[model samples]
Target: MAEAARGLGWHPFPGPAAVNSVRYQNRAACAYHGFCDRGGCHLDAKNSTAVSTIPRAQETGRLQVVTEAHVRRVEVDGEGRATGVSYLKGGEEYFQPADVVLLASYTYENVRLMLLSKSPAYPDGLSNNGGQVGRHYMTHATGAGVLALFPHRLNRWYGLPAQGVAIDDWAADNFDHSDLDFIGGGNLWVYSDRRPIAAARMPTFGRAPRWGSAWKAFVADNADRWTNCYIQKSTLPYEDNYLDLHPTVTDPLGDPVCRITADFKDNERRIATFVQDRMVEWFRAAGAVEIIRQGLGTMGPSTHAYGGTRMGDDPETNVVDRWGFSHEAPNLGILGASVMGTSGSHNPTLTAQALGWRTAAHLVENWSSIAG
Candidate 1:
C-alpha cells in the first residue's frame, strides 16, 4: 500500500502531460455537502476511473468489459481454482471463462458476490472458511452546522463548496490530543451556493411554518443569505456493525442486496459533539448572528463506504494480503474501498485508484508467483 500523500504536501509541479485547465463543469448545487452543484462535472474535470484506467483497460484487447453484465457467481474448478464467472445480461445468463477471476466490484457488492457463489468443496462459501466475509465496515459520520439571519446580504450563493476553503486544523494528527475525549478530528468547511430547489428545503430553524405566506416571505428574505458549515468527522468500526446478505430482500435478478447493520460508538458521538461545537465557534467568528448546530444522529448510507475484505498480512484478520491478493485464492485479486484497512481523513476515490494501480502492477511484475 502507498503512503497516503496529503494536499498539505509540497505542491506538485505540472508535468509535461498535464492539462493545466478546468476540464469539466458541474453546476449541480446539491451534492453530499453542496459540492459539485453544477448538475455534474460536464467537462470531466473529476479524475475518476470513468476517465482514466477503464479506457486504458479497454485499449488492451486482452481485457473484455461487459458493462451491463451483473455477475451472479464465481465458477470454480475441481481443485479449488477459479475458472470464470456466471452473469446475467438482458434477461439471459452467460458465463465468461478466465484463468483467474478478480472481483473489482464496489465494497458491498464484492462481499455479496462471494457469498452468492457457493460450491460443494467450499460449501460455507469461497473465502468464508472462518466466516469473516462481511465485517468491519466504516462510514463517515456527518452533520451540518447552519447559521441564518444576518443583518446584511452575504452574497452566499456562488462558487463550488470545497473550492472555497477547508480548515483541517482539527483533522487527524494535526492537533494535540491531551484533553480530547476522542482520538480523531474533523475538517471545517464553509461555502455558499444553493439552488432554489435546494434552498426551499433548508432547515426552518423552528421559526417559519412549513407552508403559507410566511414561508414565502422567509424564502424571499433569507434564501441567499444563509451559510452552511460542514464538519466531516471520522468514524471507527465497531464489533457489532457489518454488512451481510439481506435475509428477505433480493434484487431484480433474484440476488440478495447487501444489508448494513451498524450503530455509532461513543467515540464517534463524542467527536461529533466536539466538532459541531468547534464549527459553531467558527461560524460565530465569521459573523454569524444566529447559529444552529446539528449533531451526528443515527448513521445512514454513506458515499464513502469502506472496509469489508480488508487487506492485511494475517488471514485471521483480513481477507486480502497487503498486495490486494486473496490469501485463500492465489489467483484472485480484489479492488476498491473494501480492501482499505483504515479510513483516513481523506476521500477514498483517489487513494483507491492508486492502490488499484499498485495492485495491477504487482500482478504484472510477479505474474508467475501469483498465478502459479
Candidate 2:
C-alpha cells in the first residue's frame, strides 16, 4: 500500500498512535490481541489516562476520584465566578467547592453543563453572557469509507486499529486547492484490525444471497480476503451548525440534553467525493478485485466531536480565551475538544491532551491571580 501510494505522488507512512510499541513508563507494549478495538486493553498498553496519568496523580495523595457521580452544574458566586460543582451521587446531591474549576467533559456534556448552570449574575448560562458557549460546533467529516476485496488471504487476523498505513497527501491543506470547491482534504488509513463477528457481517458484493447456503459460503471464503480504508476529512465550524439544550427532550434527571443541529455542508461533501475517488484508485493499485464505496451520510453522533465552547481571543465569538479559561468566568477553565475551533483531518485526542496540559500549567503558573 505504501508503494502504491508513493507511486501516485502521495505521502504514505505509518499512522501515529498513542498505543505503546515498546515498554514505556512501566506499562507493557501492545499485545496485538485483535480485541483492542472492542474494549480496554488488559495489558494497559493503550496509554489511556486510567493506566497512565490518573494512577500517577493518585500516587501524589492529592487527587480524589469519585466514581459514579453525575455532575449537575457549576456553582457560581455573586460575582459570577465558578465556586465549585454540584453533582448527584447515590441519590444525594452534593457540592464540592474549589478555588479553580476545570471542565473537561466531552464536547456535548461540556456545553450542556455550562448551559444548564444558569446564574443570576449571568442570566443566560455560565460563561454564556456573550451567547458563544455553543456557537461554533463541528465533527470530523468521517465515515466515508471504501471496502476492497482481494483474491488471496491478507493474514490480517491479529492487529490493532492504530496499526495502519496512512496517506496524508490529501489531508488538510497539503495539496493546492486553487481549483477545488472544498478547502480541506482527508487522511486515508488502511489497517488490518478484523474481528470474527464483524468479518462475518461483510457484504456479499452482489455475488451471493443475503442468507442461507450462498451467504455462508461467501463468508467462509471471503472472510479474510477483504479490507476497508478509513477517510478522516477536515471539517470546519459553521454558523448554523451549533449545540444547544434540547427544548423538549429531558434526561432521567429532568434536565435537558444537548441537542446538535449540524450537517455536512457542500464543501464537506465535495471533499468526501474527491477523497473517495483517490481511495478507490489506491485500492485498485493494491490488487483489489472488488471495491464498495459508502456514501457521505449526514453527520451524526461521533467519537470525534469538537467545538461548542470554542477558544479564541475575542469574547464575542468564543466562550474561552486562548488560555482555555472562560472568557466571562475568569477562574473557570475548559480542557477538552470543546475548546477546539476547527476539526482537522485527524483524531483530536492528542491535541485535547496537549491543551489540557497547557491549561493546567497556565493555572499553576498564575495561581494567585486566576484562583484569587
Candidate 3:
C-alpha cells in the first residue's frame, strides 16, 4: 500500500484499518470480510456511532438520549425563533424544548423538517425567509471504469473500502481543464476486492457470454482476474437540482417524504468520460488482458448529499450565516453537509463532523447572545 501510494503520488490518507465509525468495531479490529459495504457489522468490530459516541454521552449523565425519537419538525415561536422540536416516540407525540435548537439531521431531513415547521413568521418554513431551505442540493456523481481482467492472481480477497489507492491528479482543479467541456473532474479510485459476489458480477469482456454454463465456468476461472476503477466526480449544485417534500409520498406519520429532484449535468458526464479514458489508459499500461467499458449512469441519492440549507454571508442566497446559524431564526444552528456550499470529489463525513463541532463550539461561545 505504501509502495502504491509512493508510486502513484497518492498522499497516504490512511486512517484506522477499519472504516471510521462505530459500526465495525467488534473483535478489536475490522475483519476485512467486505461486508462493511453491505450490512451492519455483526462482530462489533465496527466503530459506528452506536458503539462509540452515544455510549460516551450516556456516561456523562448530563446527556439524556431519547432513543427511537422520530423528529417531525423544529418548533418555532411566533417571531420565527426555534423553541425546540416535536418528535414521535413510541406512537406518542412529544415536544422537547430547549434554550436553543441545533439541527444536525441528514441534509434531506433537515430541509424537510424546516419546510414542515411553518408559521406566520416563516410560512415557507423555519428560517426559510430567503427561500433557500431546500435549494442548492448537490451530490457526487459516481461511475465505474471498465473491468480490468489480469492473467495472474491478485490475492485480494479481503480488505475494507478505505484500503485502496486514490489518484487525485484529475480530481477537483488539480489539472488544467480550460479547454475541456467539463468544469470539474473526478478522483480515480483503484481498490482491490475479491468478494465472491463481486467477482460473479464482474462484466464480461469481449465476446464472453453473460449467462449459461459457459458464463459460470468463465466466472470460476477468472474470478480473481477482475477489478474495477471507480470515479467519484465533482458535481455542482444548479438551480433545477433541488429537494422538496414529495406531494404524493408520505411517511407512516403522514409527513411528506423527502423528494429528491436531482440529476447530473453535462459537466458531470463529460468528467466521467475524461476520467474513464484515463482509467482505461492506466489499466492498459498495467497489462490488463481485457477491459469491459461501462458508462456513467444517472445520479441519485447518496451518503454524500450536500447543500440544502446552504451557508453564506448573504441572507438572500443562503439559509444560514457564516457560523451555521440561520439568518432568519437566530437561535437555530444547522450542522452537517446541508450548509456546505460546494461538493468536492470525496466523502463529506469528516468535513460534516468538523463543521458540526465548529458550529457547536460557536454556539457555546456565544450562547447568551444567540439564545436570546
Candidate 4:
C-alpha cells in the first residue's frame, strides 16, 4: 500500500502513530484491500464476538444462546434487587430468572430499559434515585474530511480505514487550548478507502451543473481527483444534552423510543474551525489542489453515545459505580459506552469491550459477595 501510494508521486507520509485496540488480528499490517471496513472480513479473519468470544463460550456446556429475544425490563424483587429479566420471543412473553443481570445494550437503550423498568421501591426509574440515569449524555462530534481535489489520480480505490494515515498533533490535549475558545480537540484522518460508487458521488466543485449531462461528465472526470479529511473531536457532556424516552413515539414493540437531545456547541464549532486550519496546513503540505471545509452539524444518536449511565464512585451523580455495577440496584451491571464519562476523540467500541471484560472479571471475583 505504501509503494502504491508512492507510485502516484505523492508524499505518502505516515502522519502519526496511533494504536488500534482491536480484539481481532491486526489489520494495520494486512493487505487492506478496501472492503474490510464494509461487510467485515470474508475470510473470518476478524476477531468479533461471533468469530472469537461466542464460539469459546459455546464450548462450555452451560452457555445457552437465546436468539430473537426482545428484553422489556429487568424484574426486581421487593427488596430492590434484580431477580431476572422479562423478554418477548415470537408473540409470547417469557421470564428468565437469574441471580445477577447485566444491561449490555447500547447507550440509549441501556438508559431506556432502566427508565422503562419501574417499581414501588424506586418510583422515578430503576437506579434513578438521584435522577441521573439520562444525564450527561454525549457523543464524539464527528467531522467528515474536507472534500479536497487532488492534482492526479492516486489510485485511492484500494486500502482499508486501518491502513490510513493520521495526524494527532491537534487531537485531545496534544496542544495548548488555553487561548482558544474550545476546550477539546480532534484527530485528523486521511484514508485512501475510496470505493468507486462513493467516489462518483463527490460534488462537482462548482465546475458543472448539479444535474443532467454536465453532472455525469464531471463525476467521471473528477472521480479519482477527489478525497476527504476526517476529524473525530472530543465532546464533553453537558447538563442539557441528554437522552430520554420519547413521550409519544413508540417502537414496534410498543416501547418508548430513546429520544436524543444534543447539538454541537460553540466550543465544538471553535474546535472544528481550528482543526480545519490544521488540516488545510497538512493537506497543502501534501499537495492538495482544492480544500472545502464543512461545519460540525447537530449531533445525532450514534453508536458512540456515552455517559448516560456514567461510572463513578459517587452514587448521587453517577448511575453505575466504578466497577460498572449499579449504585442503587445491586447485582445489576451495565457494560457499554453508556458507562463512559469522557469522549476520547476515538472510537469507543474497543474501550467498551475492555470495560465489559473488566466488569465480568469483577463479578466473578466478587460473585459470592454480590450474588448473596
Native-referenced Cα lDDT, model 4: 0.79
The 10 consecutive residues of candidate 1 with the worst lDDT sum are: 11-20
Query: lDDT tens string, model 4, 1-372?
Result: 234334434334464312233434433333456556656765455546766677778889778979999999888888889989999999899999989999987898899999999998678778988899998999877664577777787788776665577666678897787788878788777876778888877977777899899899888888988888667877888899998899999999888999888877888777777887777767766677777877655564554788899999999999999899999988999999999998877778788989999999999999998887
Candidate 3 stretches with Cα past 4 Å from truth are 1-27
* lDDT of residue 252 for candidate 2: 100
Name model 2 segments beyond 4 Å from true: none
Q: List TM-score per model, in order.
A: 0.85, 0.97, 0.92, 0.89
What TM-score number comes out for model 1?
Answer: 0.85
Candidate 2 lDDT for residue 30: 85
- Looking at model 2, the pairs that clash are none
* Candidate 4 local lDDT, residue 306: 89
From the highest lDDT down, the ranking of the candidates is: 2, 3, 4, 1
Candidate 3 Cα lDDT to native: 0.81
Number of clashing pairs per prediction, in order: 12, 0, 17, 1
Candidate 4 has which clashing residue pairs, if any?
A: 145-229
Candidate 1 stretches greater than 4 Å from native? 1-21, 24-40, 60-62, 204-210
lDDT of 3 by residue, 1-372 (tens): 335445555444443243533433234456678677667767667655577567777888978888899988898888888889988999899999988999988898999999989889898888888788889999886565567888887788887766676677788898888789888787777776557877788777864699999888888888888888667888888988898889998988888888988877888888888888877766766678888778676776666899999999999999999899999999999998999998988778778878888898898899899999
Please report, in order, the local distance difference test score of every candidate based on alpha carbons. 0.69, 0.91, 0.81, 0.79
What is the TM-score (0 to 1) of candidate 4?
A: 0.89
Error of 1 at 365 (Å): 1.0
